[model samples]
Target chain A: MKYLPYILKHLRKNWIRTASTIAAMALCIFLIASLQTVLAAFYGTIDTAATDRLITRHRISLAEDLPMAYEARIGAIAGVKRTAKTNWFGGVMGSSGGQPDMRNFFANFAVDAEPYLAMYPEYGLTDADKQAFMQDMRGAIIGPALAEKYGWKIGSTFQLESIIPPYRADKPFEFVVRAIYSVDTQKYPNHARDMMLFHWKYLYEKTGQRAGVGTYSLQIANPSQAAAIAKAVDSTFENSDTQTKTETEAQFVASFLALVGDLGLILNAIGMAVAFTILLVTANTMSMAIRERRTEIAVLKTLGYPSALVLALVLGEALVIGLLGSGLGVLMASTLIGNLGSIPGLQGFGSVAMSAGLAAGMFAVGAAMGLISGLAPAVGAYRANITSMLRQV
Target chain B: MAAVDVQSVRKIYKRDSQEIVVLDGLSLEVPEGEFVALMGPSGSGKTTLLNLIAGIDRPTSGKVIVSGTDLTTLSEGPLAKWRSRNIGFIFQFYNLIPVLTAVENVELPLLLTKLPRKQRRERAMTALKIVGLADRSHHYPRQLSGGQEQRVAIARAVVADPAVLVADEPTGDLDAKSAEEILNLLQTLNSDFKKTIVMVTHDPRAACRAHIERHLDKGVLMTTVERHDVAAPVGAR
Candidate 1:
């Protein structure tokens, strides 16, 4: 503890160099942490997906619509508990009087209320809100994040202009907000928090497209039977014009992310590059500091400090720098991520906040970097010839 | 008993497969509480002998016994521990750590001991007071003058209260006024505190302060002169 003052003074001797090195390390750590957090958020969507639920979409592509009649047929199959249909109602809420430009373009789903709510119990909604949503055909349940964003209340009415021409083209679709739902952010961080769901019957009636849904979500009695059920459901429509591709909910999310690219390989490559750069910069800083203190190190030895103590002192200095830089970097990244949730069009990307596991992993990497960087310089100090060094200026 | 005893010590350096002998079959002794000065020309092995007595270096052959402990018998770790407790060193350059304040540099050796922080600080302060640099304790080596820095180095050397103080050209870098003050301080430490001191120097004025002066040439003792004007040895006192 007493030697801490000495070590600190030595570091402060070259304050500019020390500060620059620390800042460089902090930037590297921030880049690594932010990248890893984004990757974790992408994978988190798959990890928290409901195991017992299976999604049935068009085999050719998700843009193709599936028949709404398949929901009833899939519900009749063994191990099938309940089924719900959802159609994507592409809506854009633009800037209006007394309202700031939400320019809020989001995935608004037209769903069968009762079955969809039952299958997704993670979305917490009040009983009163659920009842209100079920009673009104033109009612919508929006996520709390979306409600706060657009200043929506329980009885408020809002108009969403449909981009798809099949829906009301000249007149915007007006709907009353009936409820606001919340989900566990820790488990489903990447889950779309700014979502709006209205009645599929209302959309079908308004569009005059009587018998089509975009996707079907099936709830199975046993999660272990999901693969068998998905196979049977897909085979049921194998020869038909509207062929189906069925998969577990997790697999569906994974495949959706696969469209982006190979995220794991890219993330690993980025992480390794950042780590190597940090190691080189920190190692150079430590080496320079030790080189300047060669004579002082010899003086310490003449004062009866053992080689091991000198080595520890050098390594401890490196550790302090590493920890300080990494800690600041992570804190800065966390603050940015937390604030990103409030920005428009960035909610989904920002929803993936830094996880505790990743934060801990970053700290460990910082410490390891310090140890690895300091090893060579500390060894050089330890093995220095006290007699020859004393002769040096 | 002798505070420092060197028995036929020899030191050789090897450079590119060629051996250069610095000290050959050199032996010397200084009684407890006696101040001795070694004067010689450049490369006359005075500093080399001082290093052997201080336990900072080992003899090529023969033994170096200081304060009744044979330094050659001890390994590097134990020898360091013994040196810290028994020998205090003052160098030509002061060698004060540039980063530390005057008092912090003095307090360094005490850190190796089991003393609590308060006690260590007090002892360090007391040592600085003895060297009359108590007021400059907070100043760093760069902030102090050459003489003041050397005084702080002296404080650091004596803070551990070692049996013998080894000084190599202690005033070689100081002005005449500062050099005289340092020599007076060394005389006071030897006479009043009864600290046995071994100083290696080329200055005859510095050698006159010691009770006994020894000259060396070619790694061999040339002559020993007793200073009649100086106070009697501690035993006589």
Candidate 2:
């Protein structure tokens, strides 16, 4: 505590430089934290997935579809508890005449109404919502996320273009949103927060007698029978001209990641590099401050100051810088994330949620940076000689 | 009682890959209440001997005992503490921290004590009053004239109520008038308070005021005189 004045005096000596260094650290850390948030949202989807449920797509790929007739056959099989079928609507509403109206064409599909609700109870939907959705012929149900995205409601109308094949240059498809179904949890919940569902009959009548169905989502009586059912389900369609690759619903969801393909690994590697840079820059700055305080340390020593007190001085200085920089970084990240819609890159991903876990990680990193930077200089002070130190002009 | 004992002190230095001996078997003694001047040519071991007596630097081989403590026997940490309580140093450059006020500069030594802030302030003010600069207590070191700065240094030196005062060319950077005021302050600190003063200077006029005078040359003390003897070492030689 006696040495606090000395540390503060040293800090005040280079106020501008210290302030700038702290600001730079805060910005870099904040950016790094935000990047991690987006990545978390991406990976968090897979981490929080439900294991009991299963999704069966076309033999070859999700873009291809299976016969709607097979839905009954799959349902009739042993251990087949309940099933839902959802087909991609490929809806695209344009933000501009230019930018491909579809928003990277992320995720929009139509599901088998009753079974889709039964198979996924995590959606926390009310029975009234289920009945309202099922009772209407023009009935269409939308995920709450999609309703907020396009501003649709129980009686709201939605019109969008199909990004799928037979894409017309001039025409956009339309759907009257029946009811909005809620989600149980977020797993890769869309960045735009758009999740769509429509009546299978509507798809059949609109795109009438369609060549194929998108994917069949299933929930089984015996959760352990998933692997066998998946295998058997695939073998039944094995030699039917279109080859099949039926993985468990979990694997099916995990496989969708092939689109980004190793990029996340590259991002993680880059994040490690960025973290190291923060350590170096912060360390170099603190070391410089310590070097400059050599004479002051010597002065204290000459005045009968103890070595332990000197050590505390340097460590205290480092901690101040760390706390300031890290605290600033955390504040900026939380503020930016809290007001996510205003941030530039984040607008594409909706409002980013700043998790407590992310903030804790940042604080820990800042403290470590401070300690590492201060270690060398403080040790140097501890070994100073009062005679020559006082002699330094 | 003798305040400082310097016996056969030896000091060496290496500069630009050249070995240079600064003090060789130099011996000097100052009794309590004595104001002695160490007079010599530029590299004549005057400052080196002063350092040894103050317990700041160790002799390469002989005894430097001050105030009943052998400086050579004390380790670096204990030596600093011993020096702070027993010796006061006035540097040629004044050596006042630029950012600190005169009171704060004087209070620096008290930081080593467990005195509360209020007590430290009172003690610092008293020290500054001894040098007749109590009014300038709040003034920063940089704001003071050369003589006033030296007075603050003197206050810092005597603030801890040390047994011995060591000055290394205290008037080296002052003008004649300022230098005279500093000499008067040193004289008052020595005679009025009976603080033992060991001053190292090249100026013969500065040496003239000492109660005893000593000259060092070729790393050894060659001449010494007292009040009954000559006060100017050059004249004594």
Candidate 3:
């Protein structure tokens, strides 16, 4: 323990090298932890998806819309308790009326009011808010994150210009905010906090599209019978022109993320590459430090410090640097993600957190990195010939 | 009993299939409290003999018994432990750990003992005071002059109160006045503390401080010359 001061002094002797190595390690660890947290957030959404709900989409592709009539048939299925239809409005809050740039764009879904609220109990809304939303045809429920972002209070009106017209060709679709909804950010972190939903009847009436429904979300009474219910719903529309694919909500979420590419594989590749680069950099740094300290190491041996002690000292120095670098990196990553919640486009996605288990895993990686990087140099010092090393100076 | 016993020791090295003998059947003895110097030219095995006596290296064929323990028989681990307790070494370059302060360097060997931190610190301070460098104890090696660094090294050597002090050209790197000061300090350590000193130097002036001087040539002890300065040996306290 008394040798710690000496070890620290040795590190400080080559301050520039030590600082650069630590900086490199910190940057690598930050990249790794950030990538891992993003991957975990994507998977966490899938993992926490409601198992009692099932989604029925067009079998060919999600872009293909099914008939609105299928919602009634799917709702009448054996175990289904309620059903809701949603259409992706694909609207952009345009540059009109002093709005900011294109970054304010968010998901706007036209959904059936009563049935959608019934199917999604995770979205916590007050009874008064629900009543107001049901009463007004032009009323919209905005996520709390979205409401806070655009400073939209209940009763405030906003317009979304449609990117895919003729929902709004010359005039934007105007919506009065009726409710601010909140969801379990731990589960639906990217969804309920960044989305807006108005009445599907409004879109139907304005666009005069009577039979189009993008997808149907069904809630079943018996969650264990979800597979049977999904199979039955798909079989009902099998031979029809608009074939349907039904899956449990978790599987549906997983498939949706799959469209974004193989997130897990991509993250793993990035992580391995970063770790390998850090290992090389750290190993080189430790090698240089050991090479420079040969005489000091020999002096320690002459002072009756055993070879094992010498090896441990070298390894301990590496461990200290690794821990310092990794700790700073992870803390910075967590802080950045935590504070990103207020950013316009990054609202709900900012809820991605550094879990305790992930932090512990990163710490283990740091320790292993330190030990492995220092191994060759520590071994060299341990087996060094005291006579030869003494002659070096 | 003799403080150092080198009994027919030999040291050899192999360099890429060629055999080299650095020490060939060299033997010597020095009684307790006697100051002895071994003088030889470069590659004459003077430092090799000093290393053997300090138990920092092992002989190829024979025994190096320092203070009654056979160093050649002890394995590496045990030899380190024995050396920590019985031997203190000074090198030509005054090998003080450059990063450590003078006091920290002096307190290093005492860390191997069971002494508490306070006791170790006190002993190190006492050693620095003995070498007249107590005020410079807080300074690092780079902050000190060459002579000051050697004084710190001497303090480090004696801090653990080892039975024998082996010095290999301790004054080799110093100027004339510093060299004389170092020699005087060594003489004080030998006479006042009754430390058994074995120094290796090629300087005749440095060798004159010893009670007995030995000459080595080509890995062999050639002759012993008695110095004019003689004193009765002090028994161990």
Candidate 4:
């Protein structure tokens, strides 16, 4: 601790190099942290999924819809406690000129509103909002994030154009907002308030009972019986017009992510590459810094500073750079995450803010990188021959 | 007892499978509180002998007993601790840490001890006062003149009150005026403060300040010159 000033002074000896190295570390750490957060969000849904819930979708593909009649049959399954039907609306909100704008795209869904809301206890929906959504056929429940983005209040009417089949009409579908649901961002980092849910019956009736359900979310009585019940549900619809594939909610989310390729591996590869590059950069910087101070180090040894102390001084400088870089990078990441929810394309990631654990993990990684980077030069310092070093010009 | 005793010390270096002997069968002794100057040419191995006496380097196959401790027998760690307690080293270029102020540079050796911070600063200030640079204690090496920096280096060397001071051409880089001041300061440290000084120098004028001068040539002691002893004996102090 008494030698901290000594170490700090050496860091400032070449202030330009030091600052540039720190900046490089910060940028790399920031990139790695952001990549890790996105990866976490993709996998977080699995960790936070309800054990008692299962999702049944078209076995052929998610693009293929399931029969609305499957809901009643699914509800009758032995371990099934409740069931709700839902379909992806793929709605694009209208711009000021009343044209579909892809930038305002959101995951609007037509759902069995009451049963769907009941399945998700994380969404703190009020009784009044539920009743209002139930009483009016055209009433819709929206996520608080989406509502805030469009400034939609209860009873506010808006037009949405469906990009999916059988719902493209000359006149856009109009619906009134009945409730804005809230979710705990910490508890559900991936399931942010970026989707809208309205009565499925309204879409069915408007399409003359032609539109089918996209998925069925089922709450089971026994979580342990989930696999058996899923098998039973799939077997019941085997060889049918639209075969059913059922899985636990966690497996459902994982499969959905898998459809976009191995994102986890890609993210991990990116993180590893960035870390390796920064490690090399930091090691090079430390080596140069240590090399330049050979005479000074020999002097320190001459003054009776032990080899261990010299090694520590070198490592201490690297650690300070690592920590400063990581601290600044994580701060930038958290701030960016705070504003991500308002971005149209990244609304779902709004709630994926940096956790304390994640932040600490980043700092640990930075510290470890610093330590590893300092090893070669620190060993050189530790084994330095004072007389030989002093003899150098 | 002698403050520094080099017993037939031999030092060798190996370069690309060839052996080069820097010092061979060198024997010397300096009594407690005696000031000695070692004079030799570039490759005469005077610095190597000084380093062995200071315990910064071990002899190839001989013993170096400084302040009654056999440096050859001590391992690197204990040798360093022993050096901290018994040897004060001054480099030719006044190699003070560029970042530290004068007092801070002087206070560096004290960091190895368990002394309180306040007492360390006090001792450093006292050492600086002895070097006649008390007012420039807060100035960095770059901010001070060459002579002032040398004085600060001398202060750093003596701050721990080691058993002996070993300087390798202490005023080699300074102008004549600064060199005289440094030589005068070294004389005061030897006479008034009773420090045991062993200085390696090529300049005959600097060697004149010491009580004895030993001339070396190609790793062997060639001659010895005796001067008037200015400082009292250790017992008298």
Best by lDDT: 4
List the DockQ of the predictions in order: 0.67, 0.39, 0.67, 0.71
Off by over 4 Å in 2: A87-94, A98-109, A136-213, A222-226, A248-250, A258-261, A281-284, A339-348, A386-392, B14-19, B99-107, B121-141, B191-194, B228-237
Can you write out model 4's per-residue Cα lDDT over A1-393, one digit (the tens) per residue?
Answer: 888888788788889998888888887778888777777777777888999999999998988889878888889989999999988888777754555576777778898887888888877688988999899998988888777878999999998888786866656778999889888766765676777888899888877788888899999999999999999999989978889999999999988988444866876788788889989989998998898889888888888889998898889998998898888888887777777766767656755777788899889887888888888899899999998898885
Q: Lowest-scoring 10 consecutive residues by lDDT in candidate 3 chain B?
A: B228-237
Off by over 4 Å in 1: A88-92, A95-107, A148-151, A159-168, A184-194, A206-212, A259-261, B231-237
The collision pairs in model 4 are: none
Q: What share of the true interface contacts does candidate 1 keep?
A: 0.48
| Number of the candidate with higher lDDT, 2 or 4 | 4
Candidate 2's residue-wise lDDT over B114-135, tens digit each? 8999999999999999888999
Each candidate's clash count: 0, 3, 0, 0
TM-score of each: 0.93, 0.82, 0.92, 0.93
Assess each prediction's global lDDT (C-alpha) against the native. Answer: 0.85, 0.75, 0.85, 0.87
Return the lDDT, model 4, position A273: 89
Worst 10 residues of 4 chain B by lDDT: B228-237
Off by over 4 Å in 4: A96-99, A146-159, A184-191, A206-210, B229-237
| Candidate 3 per-residue lDDT over residues A119-176, each given as its tens digit | 8877789899999999999999988778777899999998887665446544677899
How many angstroms is the interface RMSD of candidate 3?
1.0
For the predicted complex of model 2, DockQ is 0.39
Q: What is candidate 4's CA lDDT for residue A21? A: 83
